[model samples]
Target: MDTPGPRRLAGRVWIVPGDPDPENIRGSVAVVADDSGSVVVDAGQSPAHAREIQSAIRAAGLPPARWLVYTHHHWDHVWGACAWPDVEIVGHVSGQEILRREAARPWSHRYLRDEVRANPRLGPSFRARALAMQGWDDFTILPPGRTFTDELTLPTGVRLRHVGGAHAPDSTVALVPDSKVALLGDCFYPPPAHLRAPDDGPDLAMVRDLLSDDYEWYVDSHGEPTTLEQARRLVST
Candidate 1:
């Protein structure tokens, strides 16, 4: 619930959190800001949260969002994307398909029912959050304007390399090469394991190897910024 501190790296990249809670919402939205423009990595829980992200971008003297990159098709990650009107949205080709499927399914409703069944203690909070998320109809089916399997570069000189997936079927970790900072979505999070482990799509070993090669600082979608060494240690354990 606390606001995450903003961080800046070498390539004029900034990491801002859209949501910090891990129990209900498993991911934190991030913004990759540079001189040319800003690209929102993932939309947070609601339109208001997405608006807060937009406000943060404006406060930092950046232009309107030029692009949106969905790490995967998870509801929490893509729901608020409608807040950005007409911006080019980008993601993996598989992610595009997942988004279409999610649009047809009662994802939020199912999540609410599952939350109550799994943890009765937090059922009230879960219902409240789920209802808040459902009220946002902006999650229209918007396919990625640009899709890639391996990697893609934005006009602002940010390179989004799809190292491997960890959190979801179409999940990808975005790397800003120049900054040596990687936006490893829900692939990595702080310890004590609050959420269920994602099905093993991209082997953790592959992710570890990818991180070791070029990344120095890693900005996770859930927790605080971590170093490659720290990530390796976490994965090893």
Candidate 2:
């Protein structure tokens, strides 16, 4: 994969794109560096992907990540935390609730198997992911040891806010105030048809309000980073 450059703003920022799929499920991770140390947003697609992302961050001149944050509760976004056994994880309380619920119900590969059996079109991709998640039975749910309800200020000067977005209920976005860059995890992706019943998604009005933010660079999880104008346009899509 051609690694993207470390696009700098106020502080150093790097976007590590992961395994892209037509479904746009493979989420990317953001690595931010300030004077204090490094901060990684979201894990990657898997454990191995998480490790590779760490190497890429080092190559970009950032120090080891002092924090690992989750954008939401989706498996594709949070599964990589397995690689960072000791990093202090940070995220929204909603995510912890979802993980704990799922852990108690013990949601696992069987759900995907049933999904694939119901929709034959999903067989190949689901099988591939299952194989990639070979040790998923041993996959431990790593809830954020530190969680916030609305917003919190990090020691590194980065600010995190819980933004109930279109994609998931517990989405969080990080702002590097000095640089005017905002790392938006999977906070705004359009959900699949299956998840559109109650149509739980980012409130467009709220997104419009958030877009009015002074952030120049808006980074999304599944694709390339965009300008404030481009992100504002996406609020319509």
* lDDT top scorer: 2
Cα-based lDDT for every prediction = 0.67, 0.74
Clashes of 1: 0
Report the lDDT tens digits of candidate 2 across residue range 1-237: 434544454457767775566443566778777656688888875676677787777787787888888878777777778787557889899889887775565445897788778987666556655655656655666778899999988888789999876678888899887778888776665664455556565456765666746788888776777888887787788
After aligning candidate 2 to the native by TM-score, how far in Å is the CA of 56 from where it should be? 1.1
**Tens digits of lDDT, candidate 1, 80-100:** 777777578888888887777
- lDDT value for candidate 2? 0.74
> Where does candidate 2 stray beyond 4 Å?
1-10, 104-111, 118-128, 197-203, 233-237
**Residue 148's lDDT in candidate 1:** 92
